[model samples]
Target: MNNFVLLEYAAWGISALLGLWMLADLIYTDRTYSEEMLTSSQEGDIEDSLVIDPTQQGGQK
Candidate 1:
């Protein structure tokens, strides 16, 4: 019983450490940015032409 308890504790500690390491890795990773791909004028044009059709029903209707 004592050995089982110790093994369970060790497993819990290792799982917690791995979870923390993954969280830190996700938070500190660098995101890539590209400036030459999209300009302000293009962005505005895209926003203006975008439309949503809410009245379209699925196969049920």
Candidate 2:
């Protein structure tokens, strides 16, 4: 019933909670998204769609 024993139990409880959360998240993601969709390369395509121009956005010249 010392402070160290209480701290150790708290640490174990946090660890168990984190592990269960990660497991649930993994299962949810696996069931919601396909492997190919998760692995698709859409970063560049999204970046190319943006118009980055301070002048056109009403900024000082």
Model 2 TM-score?
A: 0.63
Write down the RMSD of all candidates, one decimal each. Answer: 10.2, 8.3
Assess candidate 1 and give its lDDT.
0.62
Q: Against the true structure, what is each candidate's TM-score?
A: 0.47, 0.63
Q: Across residues 1-61, which tens digit of lDDT does each residue of candidate 2 receive?
A: 9999999999999999999999999999989999997886555554563444558677679
In order of listing, the candidates' clash counts read 0, 0
lDDT of 1 by residue, 1-61 (tens): 6999999999999999999999887666533333453232343444453332334433233
lDDT of each: 0.62, 0.83
In TM-score terms, which candidate is top? 2
Highest lDDT model number = 2
Q: Over 4 Å off in model 2, which ranges?
A: 42-61
